[model samples]
Every structure is written in C-alpha cells, then in structure tokens.
Target: MQVDSKAIDKFLVELLTEVGTRLREDSIKKMSVATKKNRNDLVTNFDKKTEQFINGEIKQAYPDATIVSEEGYGDLVKDMSGLVFFVDPIDGTMNFVKRGDNFASMIAAYIDGEPLNGAIIDVMDNEIYHGGKEIGLFINDRKIDNPKNLPLVEGLVDVSAPMALANKFAVQDVIKKSSGFRVYGSAGIIFGHLLTGKEVMYMSYLAPWDLAAGRVMCEAAGMSVVSIDDAPINMLESQVVIVGTQKVVSEALKTLKTR
Candidate 1:
C-alpha cells in the first residue's frame, strides 16, 4: 500500500489538537500526577490518555505501522525499517506535572528508516510545529521563513540542563563558541526554536521519541540533525542529538568527543 503521508499528517494534526484540548480540560478539573521510574520522570493521567488517543489514531491511519511511544501504549520495535509513528504524549512530563507548561505532544513518522513527517504540539500554548519531506515547516498554520545559516559564534544554542553543566562531551567548548545556551526540558520546544532559527543549534541526550520528529523536520529544512559524533541518529535508540546550521554543526562536532 502506498503511504499517504499527507493524510497521515492531517490526521495527526487533528488528533494532537484534540489531545491538547483534553489535557487542558483535565488539568483544569483537578491536579493529578504520578511518578515514572524516577522522581524527575513524571507522568500524569493526561499523558497516558493522550498517548492512548494518539496511538489508536495512528493505528487506524496506518495499521501496519509500528508505534514506539513514551507511554506504555506502544511496541518494543527494534528497527525503523517500516512505517513507524514515534510518539511522545507529553514531552515535558516534569513540567506538566509541576509547572504545567513547556510540555508538548510529539509525533514522528518514519518509513524504512527515513523520516516522512513530524508534528509537535505546544500543548500549553496551542501552537503546532509541523513539517515533512514534501511540505516544509509551519508554526500554527503560518509557514516559518527559513532560518539563517549561522556559525557557532553567531547564534543561540539549545542544550539540556545536565548536558550543559556536566560539560559532558566537551559541551563547554560549544558554549564558549556560541553566543549563549538555553535549556528547555522538552525536546519538542527546542525543535520549534531550531526550526525558526531562533537558535543556531540544539543538543541533548535524546530518546527515540524525543529525537524522531525533530530529526526529519530539521533535515528537510536544509538544516542538520545528527548525533554528537556527527552520525545519523538511530531511530530505535537513544543518543546525543546535535542540530544546527551546517557550519555551526561542523564547528560543534569538532569539539565533541567521539566514543
């Protein structure tokens, strides 16, 4: 069967919108939360429900497609060789549970290890960052202009709080080269900033669901998305993500430690 990427994108847009609305309503009704594997790793009822909703929709849209999601509502797929919807029902679960902001619902569609489409819903603010191979990116229905091809010293960089401070992977060197660094817990939000060119680069210890959507979108926009080692990220695993303009990426990679 021919993959209808457009139809899938449309379905995901509507689905994420509905999920965001429901999450907001749930938040207003009551304050409910749960802890995941650790205290920092939080999960709300809304998270599970939203994942369920999105998972069911994706199954309906492409029954053969495998889903690897943040919540328990997906499979333990070992590869991305076929159609797959990598989902993060709540990208910033800690924020959602504590601050009630900075959270997002993210989805990435990949076929045969190639990214087809991606959508990240800024649930708190109701903005959708959407993109695909054929259609470019949009911030809530408005097409975003292309970001500048900035070098390392000329632009903002998005980094995780831990990665930034631990000076892990010689990240301190990147900070010294860049104008500054900003840490947003949610990968989806960082992705939004990257696509808009508000920052020169974004890096983190990203999981499959965390990196999937942003990887494809940034690549489609003539930007770069790769691991700290300047290698393509594996969709089935977690790794260090580095995204930026071509030049900035080149500079940052030079500072990164390859394992």
Candidate 2:
C-alpha cells in the first residue's frame, strides 16, 4: 500500500499537536519527576503514554506501517525497505524533566526507505514544523521560506555540549569558528532552528527517532542533513547528526576528523 505524503504529514501534525498540548496540560497539573535510565538519561510517564497514544493512532491508520520509536512503544525495526513511522514521544526527556520547556514530540513517515512526510512539535511553545515531499513546509498554518545561504562564521549553530566535552568527532574546532554555539538538547527544537535559519547548523549524536522527522523537514526546506562524513543516514543505527545550510555544512565538514 502506498502512503500519501500529504495525508501522512497532516496526520503527524495533528497527532503531534494534540499529544504535545496534552503534555503541557499534564505538566501544569502537577510537577512530575523522572526515572533514570542512567545518570544523564531520563524518562517520564508522559513520555511513555504519549508514544503509546501516537502509536495506537498509527496502527489504526496504517496497520502495516512499522513503528520505530523511543520509550519502547514501538517494534524493533530491523529492515528499512517498507513503510515505517519513526516516533519520538519526547525528544528531550531530560529537558522536559529538568527544565520542562525544551522538549518536543516528533514523527516521520518513510516509504520504500525514503522519507515521505514529517512533523516536529515544540510542546512548550505550541509550534509545529510540518513538511512532506508533495507539499512544502509549514509552521503552524503559515508557509516558511527557505533560508538564505550563509557562511559558517556569520550564522548561529546548535551543537551538543557533551560532544565537545568528549571531543566526539572533533566538532569543538567547528564551534570555535562559528559565530556562536547553542545547545537546546532536543532534536525537534533544534529542527526549529534549522527551519527558521536561526541556526545554520544543528549537530549532535542522535538515534533514529531523533533525526527521523527533522531529516524530512530539513530536506524539504532546502537544507542538508547528514553525518560528519556526508554519508547517507542509517535509520536503524545511532550516528552523528549535522543539519544546516549548504555552506555551513561544507565548512563544518572540515573539522570532522572521523571521516
């Protein structure tokens, strides 16, 4: 069964907006604590519930679509040849648990191993970034323009601070050359930066759920998303993420020693 990109995009935007609003309402009702998967890793009840809710909806809408999601609400997706949905109930679990403002809900639909449509909802801000192959991207109901070409030293950049501490892939040098660096900890919000051209680039270590929606949306907006080495992203594996304008991406690649 072929999936319609427009239908998928609309469904994801609605689902993300609905669930993200619920998360905010849930937070206002009480102060929720998070459980630790490790020292810095965290999860909350809302995260699990949100994924389950979205997953249930996907099952009803597209029963054959494989789900690869965070928080264990999805199946183990080993193959990427068919239709699949990548869901991240909460992209910044720690930020949601600690700061409660930087997290987001994200979804991406893939057909025949290609990204078809995606949505990223900034739960705290009530902003939705929705895009698909057939139609362009929209923030809320307004269409967004493609970012102008900018040099690495002239635009903002978002990167994970932890990666700098560990010098993972030597991105520190890239940070030094950039105008400035920001770390928001959520792929969805960082994706927002990419959409607006607020940050020319967003780099970090990420999982399938983390980059799924952002990948499709970024590409739709005439941006590029790839690993440090400029390889095709592996949807089933963990990898370094770099999304930016073309120039920023080209310059950032200079600092990637891993390639």
Candidate topping lDDT: 2
Model 1 per-residue lDDT tens digits across residues 1-259: 3677777778778888888898777655445434444433334566777889889988987888999998789988987777988999888777776777888889989988888899998888999888787777778778887788988989989888888888888888888889987877888888888888888898888899998888878888888887876666788888988888999988988888766
lDDT of 2 by residue, 140-257 (tens): 8999898887889998888887887787878888888889888888889999888888899998889999999999988878888888778889999989889999888988887778
lDDT of each: 0.82, 0.84
Which is the leading candidate under TM-score? 2
Clashing residue pairs in candidate 1 (N, C-alpha, C atoms within 3 angstroms): none
Q: Candidate 2, residue 102: CA error in Å? A: 1.6
Backbone collisions counted per model: 0, 0
